[model samples]
Target chain A: MTEATHSAPAPSPSGFRLDRSSWAWVGVAPFLLFAVLFLIAPTFFLIIGAFQDADGHFTFRNISNLFQPSIIASYWISIQISAASAITGAIIGFFMAYAVVLGGLPRWLRPTLMTFSGVASNFAGLPLAFAFLATLGRTGLVTVFLVKWFDFNPYAHGFNLLSFWGLTITYLYFQIPLMVLILTPALDGLKKEWREASSILGASPWQYWRYVALPILWPSLLGTTLLLFANSFGAIATAYGLTGSSLNIVTILLYAQIRGDVLHDQNLGYALALGMILITGLSNGGYIWLRARSERWLR
Target chain B: MKTSKIGPWIAFTLGALYFIIPLIATFEFSLRLKRGEYSFEAYRIVLGDPRFQATFGYSTLLALATIVIGVLLVVPTAYWIQLRLPKLRPVVEFITLLPLVIPAIVLVFGYLKMYNSSSLLPLTSSPWSTNLLLTFGYVTLALPYMYRAVDTGLRAIDVRTLTEAAESLGAKWPTILFKVILPNVRSALLSGAFLTFAIVIGEFTMAALLDRPAFGPYLQLIGANRAYEPSALAIIAFFVTWACMGLIQVFGRGARGASPETR
Candidate 1:
């Protein structure tokens, strides 16, 4: 291909400048069209609609209407779920990666865990909810088995598989794996020489981690945690499948608003979606910023 | 070192238990269809049901269409960006990643209102257009993975040199892109296609909202109605996802991060 372009000097650079300049963009026109028509146009319509009144005139009514009790509670619950799941997933996944990379384990374990994480991370949404239901639901296998074996019921201890905590556990199925998938590479970026150098300087293991490893890893750790936060915040199918309309997280609430205008106001639904976009966008933006900062040192 | 080894073993065991127990429970629950005896009756019933066949077939076809559309759109754009329009790479990348930041339900919400019957374009007025809209939605959802894979593939081969070589041979732009560029990125495209297939096959929100007959909604419907079939369906879904991931691992091996040339 390179040779062909070099050899094809039929159209001299000075003669074809006008045509070349215009032709260059033609290659990307289809991509731009698709993005505008599908992605940007739809989101733009919603953002504009969020400020419009029922009669399609500009107004602040919808934005103000987002301060309602039900709507606020929905956002609160969504934040809690995202925070809880992201923190748990980050901690456990970091430890898991740490174990494999620094734990003096077998060589094959890293690839094995990585492959499993790939599957598990994508193994989310509806089937994941069902899997957790089968394992932890009221009449689920482990629930029944626990009753039979230990004469104790998990439900009796307020461990319903469709509540706030239950949803967090379900979200962790994908969240933890995603964390492991991302953090493994970051963890691998940790140099063995740094660890050895720290220990040779009479630094204890805890002191070494606190000084050298933790300082280098905090950016990736925090950035990935923010990413996990946004991931769970946008997720709906698992929660919807597990709890139905019983749990009023923001995603499911927006879903209800979309399906039936359960909010009784069309424009409020637009505002709801706009709010969701803002929250998730902020987290992702933060993730990218932190990653760029951390990668500077790693590079 | 002593505590580090012990810590990893404990973490590995717990992680394995957390990940594996769900599959075991689902499979075990799927078998208790005879009230007292373990059997494959649930799987039999699910496989026999016409609704299952219809929804699964519909989703499979939708997934195939999504893959084709994704490839047709992504391959050329990625190649062009890497070869010609390097300045637009950041803009293209940001747009591709937008779908991830914007939730599927919310994006579909934007679609429902913007293209509804009363809207300007009214994409949902006809069933075929609604299907087209849903396909576009899948493309948007799958854009991140597809673009990343193709871009990575483009980086692996010498894009500018390949384009120049193909041009020097008197080949047209289409031939250069399709014949020369596409084959070099075959494995990456396959990896992306498999990931997109897994995503589209069991997707519930878009299909349900669009009123399409898809496997995801069917599974949810069965879960709401039946007891055991849902678990059976879950197992099947897990199996399909596992196969897709396995294929991705197979095709994507050694093609990620640093290019083969660099290695």
Candidate 2:
């Protein structure tokens, strides 16, 4: 597809050559204008605002203010939850994808899993939070069933569906499905010949995974884990809907700051957004770079 | 082989249980709003509520507008890139992926700052303009998926040959684009539109922070106060998302079957 597009024949020498080139650009002008006004400009404004003080003088104070204990704690908690969910989601989703793709399962299950993953991955935000709450809240169906059938209550066992762990669990609902969706293709990239050759050469399954499969899959695995981390790190709605103001995740803190200027510094909110962009940006950059690396082998 | 299949069955079973149990639980809880028996009382109240009607209707309209605007903006650029300036593909794709790198909250924060009432553009100066800004924000959010879908669609068809064929027939640019190129990618456009609908319907951050009375904020509001209605809303939202994905699959399959090149 790319080759066909790139290989468009150059127009024969004619007076209309210049006109045609310019007109082609005109076709994309409206899209470029919309992107500038809405996407690029607003983000650049915040990036610039993050460096400016109230008086419009440039200062590093906003960035420095991020180190304050409460702010640091919020970022730390956000990172922890994101990391926890990403790692757990990666592991569980890998197993599930493996089960569907390579576990000798029925052929019908692949499309079913893919379609479910599509729905589940997009089935996020406030409604996702509500779903988890209805499933695990104090009077939830699962909670009541556990009490009645198993003689135990998660709440009595010190499990609350409104804490750091609670938030991680909720995040995994989407994270796992996203992992399954992305990693399935990478798993498909693993040629069966390599596994068959390894097995015929008397390598054990564990050895094949450790020596060959793991090395081949490492970049995608780690890169996707980073992607998942970024995915949850920047999310606010689910955490906000699940825990409200009780949990001090960075996103919730920024939400509060955005709503009421709780930090008493508008620039600091820009700084908060800057901090989020930097983290998600770096992880996504890593994901893209490692994806390029993996593509070399996969292709 | 039997042992290997057992492991897969267990994994598949656990995954299915994890995914499905929540829906079952939410549905059960939604039905329990009337106290004694399973009933659609929560769905009834939620469906009948004026606020629910208003917010859901508002979001549906916004989602439709976002789809139309997104399609209008994406299709031309993608087609132009594929047909004319293939060199700009990387730059355009990078820009589309920017939203994923930057969170929606951060993007909306940027919009709030850049287009505030005091700003020169003053997009938020009026309800109409603010809604416009909100719609644009959604277009930005959905840009990545929309562009990828349309670009893939454009690629599947023989864009160069189709363009030349239409040109030889004396079809102008607009006619060639609309009549010749678009119908070839109808399924792709529908798939992208439905995905955008799923995304914008219950979106929380942009709608909430923008102070729009869309369904996302409505869901958050109800979740904060009401109990069972939120569950009912979640069920409904899930169905909407399911419908969108199902339609995409349906249209996507149709396109594959219709286009010999796709196979």
Candidate 3:
């Protein structure tokens, strides 16, 4: 925003001087070429393809096919999962961050927790799925323990690893830590003095956080949760590996369409991909907007 | 009732315990040769696997490629824009950050569809082409981090005065660029390079889409097929990320215009 506000200076160059700092454009060349060829053009190609028929004339048939009953289940399942994951991740992240920073954790353990949280937040995806499986899957120790001692049955009880809820549980391994990492730094801006000021004024702990801290943190917490929401929205590897595309998540569905038989036509798949892009895109856009607005206050 | 000093201590312990539990489970998972016997067989299998040999090397090479490209392009552009063309900062910042706004999976999906053929300039075939695409993707991804690092460093020192002093003394753009400004912003470049390297190493979605066997995809592949190898790979990856992060910390600690690495 500020860049356009500045006045351009007269140009000069020593050693391999270019005619203009549009040469800065040259520095941008490789990224430009990559984005145009790889990212921009192909995506528009999908959009255009979605609007066009097999003969390549524009039509809404592809769009209409998007809402057919066979596919409608996918939308329902995906939205539910995204909502569940987002809420679960946000709550866990807020608590852990609160515990670490505000709940007054011991000094040595805070950094250790922070570092471990950093690693754990990055720890999910494909690797996490298998780790969780080893612990919880049939023939696994924990499963065997429950089966023998508690008379539990994953299949009978619908505690199956391949279930929708199963994937959400797997997602928390990272989502909680991710929420912790992003929200912790923002919480730092709350400062001890503000809490002390609230307490000195006779505010209860709940009141201090409710009035003083929450207001300051509302934008960041919302923004960070949105980011976590967006992250799980696009998550493909974990669910894809865990359930082998049986999970009916949007990403898994798209991967199936791209790789093989999940849909009738490829173009319909592109539209579905577009749906994922647009939804996740809007969430991310909102996150960045809130983050930018809170930057001066938070950073 | 008056054990108030234990309050923060208890919270930190619980948080730390929650964080380390999964990792400990992973360590146990990786160490189990069988139910009763503990062993390093998983690590042995991972190290001995030929795919691990090739893919791990490939991933390292890919990360280096990304860092080199990130440094080469971002350093000059960040400096030139920040110093000579401050007006272009916002535009440059916007262009650099397009990657951050667009999710990697979506953008890389776009790239794959766009550049799958030979007609495009600089287009190549699988793995190499994919790696090249990744290098560009990473640089773009890296731009926001790198530019901020260098920009902050440049702002910390007066780039205008340095450029003028060099220009008056007959130092050409290259000399001033090479000797004065770059050295001054070396910490930023180091920080940027370190951060870029970490992102590249851990990147899975792009590499998987482009069909390269980088570390992230390797983890996905191993995790799907084997029980324990994934744990080994994850630990290795965690260490690599930790080392890169540590390097960035070192780079961040040094004086601007000086090397951050210990002599």
Candidate 4:
């Protein structure tokens, strides 16, 4: 650490050049302390506690208990919802972004959509749940109108607004906008020169999208989809507000376990949170990796 | 060209419908407080309720506290890193981004365990301490936004040159930070502050678990029991979010700020 002392000979504050270097480290101490206490320590505590029995003895009992049928079902259902919403959001958001940026439309439309997308994406949680309920619930405007006007009963057709499909659709309320907000910039990165070059090379529009556009856009598209997956994976408020605890997604299940230890084991709750962190962490980590890869090409 | 226009319009229209219909439905439902006619009775009822005022007031204060703490913690740290510790940028960024990856529920769950009554710090030992804990949790949740915003703001201005100039003029560290650096990044800080306010207001899981009388829990409570009022509350919540987003847009655009929408 003192190797650089000769380079900073002008520093005489503490009569030791090494102390100047340490001042730089000291400047960040408060931030490090805050992060560790509130953020890192809490997470580390959970991970450590997950491996301990109720009496603080080290054990793998909680990890093994995670394989139970109910817990497995919760994880499965949560994954299903996340995948459904993310893929659906990505496809629609991509096309919407593409249309606004490349498709022949009013120039004002892109900014308008982008701004609305910003609001809509942030407009999640309880009120978002209510908005969907009002739109799709049994006596909701659309539902009632469909029943009264067209004699089409969605419920009789086995379409409930509180089921897996309903939750996925509800999740899309924010997911699609989030997709639009993210994909627009990525779409903007598509150079017009690339298209021109493709056309000059006798490539059809289909061929351009297939060989050039999709290749450049794939990393961003996949990364954003992964982000959306993590976004919904850990989302508890929207699902909780929409279906209450009845949805049985991992987040809500974890919420129940935290609230009352419904899992019948205190250690298992830590494991549940650990599993959640792992899933979201992996997806977000994947997103960052893919984003870095895409950014390299774009640059 | 005409055919291309058709496809784009169709996509835009479909996307708009998907977004707009629910809002329309929600507004219409909120007006259903009158049995035989449209009325703002639900709005009146919700606004008239004491619980609404109390929780909303509690959350607003909490949001303000979070913003002050978040800005104070993020700005100096971000500025310091930019000027003195560029090598640690990626590590700082990773730590800031941790909250996004680790769900709020998980973080709060950890908080419940690590700071509960019997823990070392025992943050949950009292209601006031729990509120402080929730404030810190909000700070954690807002860390990514706050740090990125201030860092970008700092980047926009020349941190090294400004600090060097201030030092040459015999300005102290506090004076340099407060008068020179902070004023330059005021817009970015406002942008971050607005976003943090928006997040803290509608936050549910953390506040609910922490047993605070925040707007999120109150909204959830009303949604569970009532019908039209929930819709009304939803619209109000939506408006608050919209207003915050709008403020960010105006301020962000003015500041020429860099904020990661996806993250």
Candidate 5:
């Protein structure tokens, strides 16, 4: 492709010299059109519907509906679940990343971990829901084990697979892998020399990591954590698949409200959409902030 | 060089077990068939089922169509934004990323509402249009991968000189795109195509919602009724997804970390 082109950065016809030609936009035209029509338009429709009533009259009802207590409870529940999963995912990922990269595991384990990360990370939605069900559902192996050993049942013990805790556990399947994938690069970024130099200077292992390594890793760690938060926050499939339409989590609620054939509650559905958008948006914003911070640190 | 600490090793073993046990149990349970004896009967059941055969066919065709159209649409769009409209990259990129925020279930629901045949534009219902919508949905998914692939390919090579050189020789835009640019980014295209295929094959919500007989819906149907066979089907689906992704990785030759172009 570059056979005919000059290797050096050549000035353009304009007085202000741009390096390469600026005709790449031609290729982007078709996709851009698709984006506007499919994505942008639908999003606009969703957003606009929030401020409008079932009768199509524009109103502030949807915005006000967001601050209601039940709505508030759903938000709080989602926040807590997302928070717990993100923290656990980050912590476990940190250990796994450290061990896999630095531990005594065989060299072949790296690609296995990578490939498993792909399968496990993409292993959400329905099959994972059923996988958990087969293991922990009422007729599940774990439930049966619990019964035989301790005379326990999940319903009596309150180990609700149809609840927030179950959702979080299922979410971790993907979250941990995603965190590892994002953080492995950061883990690799921890130069061996930095650790060696610190250790050689008579610093203890804990002290070296605490003072030096932690400082270096802070940005990538933060950025990756925020990315994890966004990833988990935007996920609807896991929650939906695990509990069906029973749970009132934000995404599931939004899905139900939108599909409200009986109530015909268009405005309320939009309000729920707003909740999802804001939740995901905040995490995305945090991701961008940390990413920029990490770039600056790297530079 | 240092010997591994016992503590972290134990923790990882436990964690890895937690991750692996379900897959193993799922496999073991699937192998249990006909009075719960260990057998390949479940596999025979799932593979031999008529619905499975039909759904698998539709799913493959849907995935292939999406990949081809997705690559064609995304590569050009990514190429356009990266090479031609650099000033509007953010705007274009933002639009492309809408699929991530707007979940497929949500969008498909919206599409069902918006693009119904009897409304707005006059169009007839056909497998072609149904495939188009299905492809369109999958393309949005494949979009980010497609975008990233083409964008990376663009970044790896000098675009201006190639285009100018082609133009100087009186080569048209399409020729430059197909002959020079597309071939350069073929690996990227295939990688995106593979991802599109993987996601589309297992996608249940859209097919279920659209009432289209794709593989995802087939799995759902089997899952609700036949237990062991569904587990077998799950394994097959997993391997299919794995093989599809492996093919993409092989073809892409290090195409990971690239952006997917979305609609």
Candidate 6:
């Protein structure tokens, strides 16, 4: 493709070569302009606002304000949920991906799993919350089934669908599938020769995985876990739809803050957004770095 | 030694159950809206609600507008990057991936602060401008997916040769882009469009914060206020997402089969 483009007929004469080359930048100007105006500028404004006072004076008060108990508690809860969901999602999704790709399952199951994963990963936000509620809420089908058939009530046993654990389980609905979708290809990248070679060296299956496969796959595993963390960390819709404001996740807090200025300080809101950006940004950056490392082996 | 299938089967079964039960429960619950009988009464009420119609229609239009703007922005830029400015690939890709790093709530918060009624742009000053801002936000959210699909599509075709051939035939850039490149990537465009529709249709945060009467906000409102109706809406939303993914698969398969270069 590069050779073809390099050898293509030059539209401009040699005298106008510079002009034509400069004109090429015009083709991308609109895109760059749009990215700057909407994507970069808005976020940049918030990041800058986070460090400013209401009177437009530079101050660290907003950042310091985030250290208060309520704000810190919200961030802590958000981190816990994101980490819990991401870790569990990765484990279950890895098993599922392994089952379909390397578990010697029937051939038809792979496409079915892939297709379902594609749907479920995108099948997030509000409807996902409703689905889980209909499944596990007090009068839900599963709850009723467990009570009628097994003589047990989840509510009586301290299972609440609007709590932290409930939200994690609901999030796994999408997270696990996303894990499956992403990890399948990584699993497929496991060369058959390695397994055969390991076996010929008298290594057991577990030994092979622990010594050979795990080393190559850990970066991807960890990276995707981080990706999932960032994914749920930034998500508001599912949490909002499930627990409403009762959950006190950072996202819900931010949502309420945005809706009514519950924080009563505009700069504090910017600091809240800045904190979210920092967390998601760091996790995503780690994911990218680890993904790059894994790609070297997988490729 | 033959590996035992027990572990894989168990894993698959457990995974399948986890995914399927919620859907089954939602469907069953959606049906139980009426007293002592299974009926589509909830569906009827939801489908017949004037607010539902208005919001769904509004979101559909917004989704279409997002698709159009997204395609217009992404296709040319992707094509240009492939054909002219390959060096800018990394920069463009990084920008596209920024949306994933920055949450929608934060992005919308930024927009409110930057484009508020008192700000320079003041996009939130009017309903029309707010809708435009909302659409632009959707476009930003959909950028990573749309760009990837179109870029992959462009890669499947011989862009340089096609452009040269069109140039020799005295066709202008727009002619070559629309008449030549676009048709070759129709399936990709459709796949991206459907995915965008699925995303923008029931998107809750941006529209809710932007105060647009989108279907997502409507779903949340109904979920907050009503019981059985929310379940019904969940079923409907699932069906929409399923249909979108199914169509993407269909077109995606078609693209793979039809493109001689791929095979």
User: Against the true structure, whose TM-score is highest?
Assistant: 6
- Model 5 / residue A146 / CA error / Å: 5.6
* Cα misplacement distance, residue B197 of candidate 1 (Å): 0.3
DockQ metric, candidate 4: 0.59
Fnat, model by model in order, equals 0.73, 0.79, 0.25, 0.80, 0.23, 0.83
Residue A54, model 3: lDDT of 73
Better of 4 and 5 by lDDT: 4
Cα lDDT tens digits for candidate 2, B1-263: 32368888898899899899999999998999887898999999999999999999999999999999998889878988897789889989999999899999999999999999998999888989999999999999999999988988888999999988887776666776778888998998998999999999999999888888999999999999998999999999999999999999998999989875441
Output the number of the lDDT-best candidate: 6
- Report the Cα lDDT for residue A177, model 3: 77
Candidate 2 residue A45 Cα shift, in angstroms, is 0.9
Model 4, range A64-133, lDDT digits (tens) per residue? 9999999999999999999999999999998899889989788999889988888888899998989989
TM-score of each: 0.96, 0.96, 0.85, 0.95, 0.87, 0.96
Which prediction has more favorable TM-score, 3 or 6? 6
- Candidate 6 chain A weakest ten by summed lDDT: A1-10
lDDT of 4 at B167: 67
List, residue by residue over A185-225, the lDDT tens digit for candidate 3.
88888877887888889988879879988888888888877
lDDT of each: 0.88, 0.90, 0.69, 0.88, 0.71, 0.91
TM-score of chain A of 4: 0.93
DockQ of 3: 0.33
lDDT (10s digit) by residue, model 4, range B1-263? 32358888899999899889888999999999889999999999999999999999999999999999898788878877887678888989999999999999999999999998987899999999999999999999999989988887887888889877876786666777789988988888888998899899989999999999999999899989998899999899999989998998887776654433212
CAPRI class of candidate 5: acceptable
Per-model TM-score (chain A alone)? 0.93, 0.93, 0.88, 0.93, 0.85, 0.94
The true-versus-predicted C-alpha distance at residue B5 of model 4, in Å, is 1.4
DockQ of each candidate, alpha-carbon based = 0.60, 0.60, 0.33, 0.59, 0.33, 0.62
TM-score of chain B of 2: 0.97
- Per-residue CA lDDT of model 1 for A132-232, tens digit only, reads 99999988989999999999998999888899899999899999999999898788888889878988899998898899888988989999999999999
Clashing pairs in 2: none
Rate residue B194 of model 6 by lDDT: 93
